[model samples]
Each structure stands twice: as C-alpha cells, then as structure tokens.
Target: MSREKLLEVKNLKQYFKSGRHSVVKAVDGLTFDIYKGETFGLVGESGCGKSTTGRTIIRLYDATDGEVWFNGENVHAKKSRKELKKFNRKMQMIFQDPYASLNPRMTVKDIIAEGIDIHGLAKNDKERTERVHELLETVGLNKEHANRYPHEFSGGQRQRIGIARALAVEPEFIIADEPISALDVSIQAQVVNLLKKLQNDRGLTYLFIAHDLSMVKYISDRIGVMYFGKMVELADSDELYKNPIHPYTKSLLSAIPLPDPDYERNRKRVPYDPSMHDTSEEPEFREIKSGHWVLCTTKEFEQYKAEMENK
Candidate 1:
C-alpha cells in the first residue's frame, strides 16, 4: 500500500437522540487513515456503527464531533455550493441494500447518468448516453440493459448499477457500505472480484465496510475491528487474522467457519466477555507493536506486549 494518506478520520463521532431520555452513540471517537490506491476494511457486527462512520465521513449525516479530512480538506466543515459539489465528486458511496438503494422508477441509463448530470461531466444527450453505456459495460452490464428499470434486474445487477452510478463521477474515494451483504453467497464473490478489478483499473481508494471477516481479509490491505462504536484494534489484514489481540476481535475471528469438516467440528467459538476488561481506568488506544493498535488499559497493555513477545 502507498504511504500517502488519502482520507483521515480523527476522533469522529456520531450520536443520535434515541428518545427524550436516551442518546445513541452510533460512532464514537474513531481514528484511521486510508492510503491512496488501497482498501481499508472496517469490520464489526451489526449496530457497531461501521455504516454510520461511512455516512458521516461522506457527509450524508453531519458528524456530532471530531473531524474528517479528505485529501487535506475538512469534510465536516461548511463549504460553498461550488466547493461542496467538487468535494462530492471526489467521494462517493455504495449502499448496502441493492433493492432499496436504487430508484425503481428510473431506468438504468438515467440512474447511472445522475452523477454525470449533476457534475456536468457530459456535454449533451449524446455524450451522456455514451458515458452511461460505457459505465454499464464497465460494470459488466451491456448497452442493451440501459433501458430497463432497476426492478427488472436481479440483486447483483442492481448493485452493479449502483457501482456504475458511483463511478460515473470518477470519484477518487468510495465508501462501500456492506455492498455484498445483501447479495446471495454465489453472487458475493462476483461483486467483490468486480470491485477489485475496478480498483485495479481506476487506481481507486476504498473504505470497505462489512461484517464478514473472511471476505474483509480477502479484499483489504488493512483492517480495523470495531465494537460498541469504538475501534478496538487495527492492523494489517494478515496480521490481524494471524494475531487478533482484543477480546472482541478474537471472538469475531473465532466465529468464521472453515470449509473442512474436521476443522468445523474442532472449532471452538470464543465468547467475548466485555467485563474481563480492566475497568479501574478507561481503556485507551495504544500501539502495542510497530503498526498494530489496540484499545487497552495499562495492565492489559503490558500483558499484550508479553503475549506478542512470547508469540
């Protein structure tokens, strides 16, 4: 991966008033950087705020606290319409649910061309039509499929259209929020391979958010483990899988089933007990190894250091 940081999120937080008496902290104090031309996977269980983090960074929802810096400019800061439009073109998002994200009323051509229209990437109807057709072909769909509405396409096809729409603006960074979770098992790999091919061709940067650790390991250069809206661990994808430090991360990794019958039979699910943490002091994110970070208290940090040394 490149050393240059394309996107930096520092202490980002998103909170919502659940009701008159309760507040839900969807994302709290998340800090990470995505390098140019690299995939940074954000993995966690549902309701851990991985989706909220993506939305907040893309400015779909205003952040309750902290800052998101994209290519050196603050994302949460207010900008003029012209500046905002430019920023929007630089960053785009692919939603989780293919059926819900696309417009049932609009044709595939119109849907893909929405970004082109808003950004004025094309000059006229002819150019727009050509661009849409090009994008459709780029995402594995043909020019003939352009006239059909989203409802006519299958789940995987709809997602390809969604990807085409995001790519229409030629964005430098894309937040793929659980893009494959809603697809069938067989179709998931196809979508992932397409995303990989697209990234290779376009030199794109991605924040691939998902709950599937196995898939995340396959696609991401680096991974961050989130629990209860806080980032508990961050490391190289292979490193994290080889040596998961946090209790929650270990618990998560243990849950992935192997294809082998023998391995599946022997696998023991590691139950995460949050109460095991040292509560005398609040846990802080600290670098235990060169590039690995984990949230832990002072005592736990020492123990983790010893654990690594012994490993």
Candidate 2:
C-alpha cells in the first residue's frame, strides 16, 4: 500500500494565554502526519491537548508557533480570502457533540446546507434542497427528515447529520474531534463503522481524536498517543498495542479493558508520573524502528534504539 502523505505537521504549537505571566501550552511543539486514505487515531487522557491539536490542524484555532502543511500547501501561512476559501472546502471538522454542534433553531437541511451555501456548491434553491436531501440519504437518514429540527432526532442520527454536514463541502480531509466519545456505547460502533465505510468509499483522510484505546485500535490504521500537549508514541495500531515503548504510552495501553473476563481480572494498570522525566529540554521525536516513532530525550532515545536493535 502506498503511504503518501496527505497532511504534515511540524513543531505545531497552540498555547492559550491565562494571564500576563501564565500561559497554558495546550499543544507544545508536536508533529505528525496523516497518510492519504488512512485514519490516524490520536488517543490521550482528558485535558491532554488532543482536541486542541485537532482544532489547530483544521485552523479552528490559530497556532502560536510551528507549521501545518496539507497536500504541500502551508495552511498556517496567510492566504487571500479566495485561497483560504478554497482551502476550507478541502478541510472540514466534525465536532464532538451532536447536540451542541448543531444549531437547535435550524432545520436539518439548513444545517447541512450551511457549508454548501458558503461554497456555492448548489447554484439554485432547488439544487440546494436536492443536495441536502442527497446528503441526508448519504448519511443513512431519510430525505423526509431534512425539514425536521435537530431535537427531533436521536443522538446517533444527529451525529449522522453532523457527518453529512462535514461531507457537504466534499472535503478531502476531516478532523473528527472525539466524534463518538459522547455517544452511547451501543451507538459508538455504528458511527465508527459508518466513518470507516465512508472512508473506503470516498477515499477521505481523517485525524480521529479520542480517549478510547480499543475503539481507536479498531478504526485507525496508525495511532499516536499524546500526553500534556505532546505526542509520545506513534506507530501502526497493532504495533503500538504490542510494543508501547514510552512510559506514558505504556500506561495508556495498560488501561484498555480486555473482552475476556479472565484477562480483565488479571490486567494491571500502569500509572504515569510526568515529573519523573527531565522536562528541561525539548525531546526529539525519533523513529526507533522502520515505522514506529517515539519522543524521547537523548539518553532515552539511545536506550530505545538499543532495545529495538536487540529485538
């Protein structure tokens, strides 16, 4: 399979100013890439800048430093409104909450058509209505429901509408910020399967951010584990699960519950203490193996490389 880079991020930083003296480094100099036609899952604990990273990538939040390149174009650099509008049509976001993300006052058709109108995808009113109806069916909703309000639908249906909205502009890349985290456990799988099917059919790339490791493993081709505003480990889903090298990555993996009752009972959770590592220097993200990447200090990087050599 070809591993063509669809999105490339280098030293991306998104920091929030708290006061004159304090600043919250939500995304502190992180870097990663999303391959074309691949879902790159980003899993991390709460308040670890996972969503912030997704927002930064989509240009929902302006970065304090670093660069984001999408298909060879630098997104963070200033562009004319026309250029920026063209960029917007190729990149879109699917927000986490189905309830809050959709406007309660707007009908489902109008909600989905917002992007279509902005991009002028449909030239006429009839065309716009037809496009919205088509999108509704594309996301598994009946065309009859296009005129209904968001409150009239279930959470899953609402999420499907959200997906349709994101798809309205025919975006090549999507940033799904914890797309299924707010959903019921039973509904999560349905949404994930829908996303996977859409990707297969549309050849869309995704930056799927979530806290659920098992779900991430199932849906993602590659996964990146983030902590405290930085990515610690990135590898193929199976490789990361089998050989998590960073202490933080190991801790996150150990928390995933197994399906087997016996294994679940015997599983031990690893606790991560960030203070144990030397935080004075900016660690380098290195490829210890052909595909596996990890962020580590000089000493730890040498140790990891040595261990990989032995293996």
Candidate 3:
C-alpha cells in the first residue's frame, strides 16, 4: 500500500451465515485505496453490498477477513477501547435515510452535539452548544433550528441536520452512504452540493456509496462498480465513462439516461440476464490498468483479456 493513501482496504470480506449450510457473501474480498482528499464513489445495484462495504470499513460491521489500513494503522486489527473511540472520531458516516438516521425524540442541538460530547471535543456546555451551532451553519442550517426536532423539518432539512451531525466530530474521513438518494430529485442536487462544499472546505476524504451513476460522475474523482458483492471495475470517473472495460461496466454506462429525447429513445436498456454469467466462484481482484482494477476468476480473466485484445 502507498504511504500517501489515507485508507487502503485489502482483500476485505464480510459474510453472514444464513441457513445451516449456506452463507451470504455481503462484501467479498474487496480491495481499494482512498486518497487523503479525494472522493471515491462506490456504485452498484441495490443489495450489491456497496453499503455493506462502507459499513464494514467503518467497523460498524466487523470484517470476516482482510485488513483496513487507515493512516498507516491497521484499523481492523483489534484495538483498545480508547484506540477505538479515537478512531471513531476520525471517521464518521452519513446514513442513506436522513429521517431514520436522526433521533425523532432528540432536538437538533442534541443530535449534533452527541458526537462532540462523546469525543470530548468541547470543554463545556457553552463550547458544545457553540460547536453544534457551527456545524449546523456549516451545512447551511440556522443556529436557531438546533432546538427543533427532526420531525419538524422537511426531508432536505433533515438531511442537512444529518450532515451537520456527521460534521460535528470534524472527521477526516466520511462514508456518505447514499446521502441524497432518499431526497426529492430537486433536493438531491442541493445535498450533493453541500457535501462537495464540505469536502472542499474541510479537505475531507470520502467513500461515496450510491446507485446513481450520473450523480457519482458529478461528485466522484474515481468510481468503483460493484456487482453481487464484488467490485467488477474501478477507474477515474471520466475515464470509466469514456472507456469502460468490464462488460458489466459497459452495460451500466449504457443505461445512463441521455439529455436528448431522440438519443434517449434510441438507446437500448442493458438486459439483466444472470444466466449469461456465472458468479458461482468468487473472483480475485486484480489490476488491468495502472490504476483500474477488476475482480474475475482466472479463466474469466483470460477470456476477458482475449476479448479486449481482439477488440
């Protein structure tokens, strides 16, 4: 792993036992690097384990195997309680549903101040209150709104409160797990813009998980495509859109809606034919380009290489 990388996840796997003899692979052997100040987008269909990967990395769900290196420290390795608490302050997550993530019973002030209090970020009640107000203001909410309950705010406003809570700890790394997906289409842009501004102003690193390729393209520096608990493709956002390598990636890009009605009507939808592919055996992630990587079995990898070469 490069020393410059802020987070280096290697062969990370998270699996859950289902029936007596079956297991559900949620995040299977995923590997990626997140730089200090870059937004890395993880995109996939629902239940593809994109969110699982984010949750596992933050230690909300312990990994079944592999390592997560944060600032040269292996975070997945068992740590003392103090170490764990310190680590928590450095990393935070913004959940998918803002309304569900916040406490309906707690006032916005208490919600934002929760992390600050836990991390001992403030010395006194006044300091904590000031910090809470500052975070609210940072995410474009007024200080006076701190006394209001989450149920009192609109969806967008509730999401802003969630963002404020995430920012309260002044984290260096954030996992924005589909932060705008639950909002109105019109509100999506506003939330996305707020996240972008926060990243720019705070120099924060992000693992942005979403299903919207268009929004991922807008906010991400690099994007990783996940399918069935594995990352099939990863590349620079523009490069991936322009020159998608994996068949799955190509299909996904083809599905992005075009602005022109004529073009939209002419474009074909990517057929979802699971029978055409086999994921019975897990694939190892390997680099196909300098910075791009994919997970494919040895036989499948050779076949894909041959096909790309022929093209």
Candidate 4:
C-alpha cells in the first residue's frame, strides 16, 4: 500500500453458502484504492454486490478472503476490543433506507447523540446536548427540531438526520450507501449538494454506492463499474463517460437518459448478453491505460484492442 492512500482494498471477496454445496460469490476478488479526500463511486445492477463491498470494507460484514487496509493498517486483522472501538470511531456507514436506519422509538436528539454518547465525545450531559444540537445544525436542521421524532420529518429530512448521525462520531471515512435513491427526484439534488458541500468543508473521504450513473458522474472523481461480483472498469469520471472500455460499462452508459430528446431517440440501448459477457473464469484487474484498470482475459482484451483499432 502507498503512503498517500487512505484506504486500500486488495482482492476482497465476500461469499455465502447456500443449498447443499454451492457458494454465492457476492464480491469476488475486487481491488481498489481510495485517496485521502476523494469520492470513489461504485455502480452496478441491483445484485452486483456494490452494497456488499461497502459493508465489507467497513467491517460490518467479515470478508471471506482478502485485505481491507485503512491508513496502512489492515482492518480485518483481528484487533483487541480497544482497537476495534478506536477503528469504529474512524469509519462510519450511512445506510440506504432512511426510514429503517433510524430508531423510531428514540427522539431525533437521542438518535443523533447515540454515537457521541458511545464515544464519550462530551464531558457532561449539558455538553452532550449542545453537541447534538451542533450536529443537527450542521445537517441543516435547527436545534429545536431535535426534540421531535423521526416520523415528523419528510423523507429528505430523515435522510439528513441519518447523515447527521454518521457525522456525530467525527469519522474520517464514510460509506454513503445509496443515500439519495429513495427520496423524491426534486429533493435528490438537495441531498447530493449537501453531501458535496460537507465533503468540501470537512475534507472527508467517501465510498458513494449508487445505481444512478448521472449523479455518480457528477459527484465522483473516479467511477467503477461492476458486473456480477467483479469490477469490470475503473477510470476518471469524464474519461469513463467519454470512452468506456468494457462492454458492461458501455451498456450502463447507454442506459443513462440523455437530456436532448432527439439524441435520446437516436440512441440504441445495448443488450446485456450473458453468454457474450461471462466472468465464470475469474478476470484479473489490470492497468490497460494510465490510471484506468479493467478485468478481462487476454483474448478478450485483444478482441477489444482489434475493435478499437478498426474504429
């Protein structure tokens, strides 16, 4: 791992056993690096293990194999209880479902203050109350709103509360797991803008997991495309959008609706053929261009090279 890298995930795999003797590989030999202060977007279809990758990296789910290194230390290396607590303070996750993530029984104040209480962030009860109000204000909610329950707020407001809770621990890294998918389209931009502002203000690093290609392209520095359980392509946002290398990535880009009606009508949807795009044989992620890596066999890469040459 390099000194500049904040998080290094190498060959990470997460598998589950089902039936008599079958294994469902949710995350298969994935590798990537997140720098100190950048949003790395992970995009895929519903069951492609994008969320599993985020959870596994944060130690919410133990890896079946491979390493998740945070600041040059392997997070899965079995540390002491004290060390684990410290590790928890540095990393946090904001779940996809805002309605289910927050505790319905607890007041908004209690929910936001839970992490602060656990981490002993405040010296006394008065200090804790003040800190909770500060967190609420940071996410655009006022201090008076802290006494109310989550049900009182709308979907967008609830998601903001979840974001406030994640920020309570003063974490250096956050896994924003589909933060805006469930909200109304009108409000999605508001939440995304808030996240971008917060990232700039705090210099936070994020692993933003989502299926929205347009929003991902807007917020991410680099975008990674996944198929089945393997990473197919990774490159800078503009480069990937301008020149997608992998077939799976090309298909995903094609699906993003164009703003111009004439262009949308002229565009053809790319079909996903399982036979033509199979990863049964594990594909190795290799650097095909500067700062761009892809997973494919040598034969498949040659075919792509030939096609590009002809074009």
- Which is the leading candidate under TM-score? 1
The Cα RMSD of model 4 versus the native structure comes to 2.1
**lDDT (10s digit) by residue, model 4, range 1-311:** 12278999999999999898999999998999999889999999999999999999999899999999998899999569888889999999988999999999999999999989888999998999999899888999999989999999999999999999999999999999999999999999999899999999988898999999999999999999988888999998998898787988888989999789999989998877757844656566767778878777777776666765676
How close is every model to the real structure, measured as TM-score?
A: 0.99, 0.96, 0.93, 0.95
Model 1 compared with the native: what TM-score? 0.99
Model 2, residue 62: C-alpha shift (Å) = 1.3
lDDT of 1 by residue, 1-311 (tens): 57999999999999999989999999999999999999999999999999999999999999999999989999888578988899999999999999999989899999999999999999999999999999999999999999999999999999999999999999999999999999999999999999999999999999999999999999999999999899999999999999999989999999999899999989999999988999989889999998899999999999999998998
> Candidate 3: which pairs clash?
none
Name model 2 segments beyond 4 Å from true: 278-282, 306-311
Which residue pairs in model 1 clash with each other? none
Error of 4 at 181 (Å): 0.8
Q: lDDT of all the models against the reference?
A: 0.95, 0.92, 0.88, 0.90
Model 4: lDDT equals 0.90
- Model 3 lDDT at residue 185: 94
Give the winner by TM-score: 1 or 4: 1
TM accuracy, model 3: 0.93
